[model samples]
Target: MAFLAQFRAAPNLLTMVRLFTIPFIVIEILDGNFGVAFALFILAGISDGFDGLLARWLDQKTTLGLYLDPIADKLLLSTLFLVLTHVGIIPRYVTVLVFSRDFGILLIATLLFATHTLRDFRPSLFGKLNTLVQIVALLTILGEKAFSSHQFTTLNATLVRSIAFLAPLSAAQYAWIVIQRLHSAEDPPRRSAPKTGLAQISAVEGADPSGSTDRVAS
Candidate 1:
């Protein structure tokens, strides 16, 4: 089902802009342009925040946006983590955990999508917190280099350790949720009717931008 009217919505446009900025951000970081890269990272985050808020405010959420937003986030963060590791900014072990958790979730999601066992991607709280911590960690690393702040050095260490633990736990949580879902599939359907638009929108609004949902967009 296509929502053509929402295709050109401001939020979707902002999301695309965020995706587009990824390559440039990577290039800046690679070239040792820490200040430039850090600024771009902030810009990307701002765009990310506004895109979802605008989607809801404008009442213009689209399935495309729902999927595109998270894809952009994962691509950018994952790519940055790898690049930063290459330059010895983020530790190799932390990068490994980040990639492992993301790929594990992606692999499961792919299997579910292939078998038609999953519908919308509901992001667990663990995944959202993991992503947030990862972002802060990235920013701290970038900012510390950009300004050589001793404070950021300590902050980066703490954030990296936080992500180290959170990443695997988040992956395990998603796996458990999927297992519960698969088991629940054996049960009979509910007597209640399908959800209404208002409820769907509310769920989407309240939903963290971590994964797909049970209901696709109208």
Candidate 2:
């Protein structure tokens, strides 16, 4: 489906705008301009939250929007984590652990999806907790650099270490839930919705090739 179908949707537009900010944020970080980067990061975060809320409020959820929103988020966070590691702000070991967890989950999800085992895409509790801490870690790093505060430095180190502990736990949590869902043999089978005679007639009449409801002479 064309993005134009949902290009006007406020939520999707915010998502697109968030993706667009990535490069500028990267530029700021590379140039040692943490202040501007922090500002931009906050902007992206706001857009992320606002987009979802606006989507619900406006009743404008589309398939494209549903997929696009998460892609944008993963791209932003993953890219920043990689870049921060590159610049020596985040520890290499922490980044390695984080990347491993992310890729492992992605791989499992892809395999399951390809095999048609699971259709519902839901976030696990630990997964959301991991994301929350990551956001805090990123903000702490940016704030430390931008403001040169001892408190920010301590907070950043704490958050990074917490992620080191939490990321893999979160990944395992997701894996466990997915495995349970896949092997739910005892669950009752899903029955298809009944299509009654009236529904069939209504469908045919509404989809008449001639596009006419009135009777016509032969």
Candidate 3:
């Protein structure tokens, strides 16, 4: 009963809906139903926007929701990137950059958690920017495919370049953040609390850093 209660919250239920929508969206893509996939993707995005707002409004934020929200977002975005690449809608290299950055961050976060090195996993600004870039890129590609629009051609090309640039840049930023936090942790005693003022605000503004949520987009 205790565990079951976690899913009872409105925000979490909405997140679960998004997770369940992913497979259908993938199937639509595989079946060459780009229009349907596009519609479903938009719907999923709507749910994502609402879940967080609902969490705050209803005071329903849970550890499970924090982790589940981003996992769903990543799963949806990453899977779409791969499938789009397979279908020839997106370039393989763009997907590669996306995967590489995400994998590297996940690897580092895992090590830190396992070793008990750091606890506050906040998303750096770069990570948030990367996530935005990736989202826009995906949406542009999907819209182009669904609508068969040549206008999106130039925009798609631009976003591709942005993704290529932002992926490694964000990864590097995350690396620096980790190093800073580690050093702060090792600080003699009083100089701890690595993030302060603007730094702390930026970290908390985005997804949860610990990769348990989107902020860590790390």
Candidate 4:
């Protein structure tokens, strides 16, 4: 019980640790140490999954965890994309599309927060699917290097193309949802004034300051 309690209290800390591993992974990959880089990547991915599950199972969910998890995932994936692209393993266009979507989302999120219109914008099915595709693409590309087969190369290329197309489509759907929610919140129904006894009394007083007999008195 004590062990579980400690884990629950520090889920976000685990996430931060995962983010820190990203730079090391990039450096290793750049140094032509794919073995260590690949291992670090897998460890990061496993920690990502573990943190979320641990938080839920231990009943230790926090707002910080909610934000940190996605940021960590983005940081790791975005860094890998750039590093892999730099090494000429993955296509540059796919990285561009992935980064563009992430940047656009961040910009929109900032705008919404600045306007005090931010809401609980949970990940949609499409967004989740896009992330899954990205992971598959990255892993497939890395696997191609590790295994070095014609089949892996062909599969990696196919995954790369799929991610390039799907990432933007998912991003557009997210943007549309944001716009719709914003518009709906900004255009609420006009409120009607209440008709109270005090209002009637005020009207009568204005009409006849002498307190002359009004319809109610009659």
For candidate 3, what is the TM-score?
0.84
Candidate number that wins on lDDT, 1 or 4 = 1
TM-score of 2: 0.82
Ranking of predictions according to lDDT: 3, 1, 2, 4
Mind giving the per-residue lDDT tens digits that candidate 4 earns over 101-192? 98998898888888778857778678999899889887766655655546777777778888898889989999998888878888978897
Best by TM-score: 3
Off by over 4 Å in 2: 1-3, 186-218
Q: Residue 212 lDDT in model 3?
A: 43
Model 3 lDDT-worst window of ten: 209-218
Q: How far in Å is the alpha carbon of 72 misplaced in model 3?
A: 0.7
Clashes of 1: 6
Can you give the TM-score per candidate against the true fold? 0.81, 0.82, 0.84, 0.79
Please estimate how well model 2 matches the true structure, expressed as its whole-model Cα lDDT: 0.87
- In the range 1-218, model 3's lDDT, one tens digit per residue, is 25679899999999999999999999999999989999999999999999999999999889889799989999998999899889887789989999999999999998898888876778889899989988888888888889988888999899888888998999999999999888987878766568876666667776344444344432
Arrange candidates, best TM-score first: 3, 2, 1, 4
Which candidate, 1 or 3, would have the higher TM-score against the true structure?
Answer: 3
How far does residue 213 in candidate 1 sit from its true spot (Å)? 46
- Better candidate by TM-score, 2 or 4: 2
Query: For model 4, what is the C-alpha lDDT against the true structure?
Result: 0.81
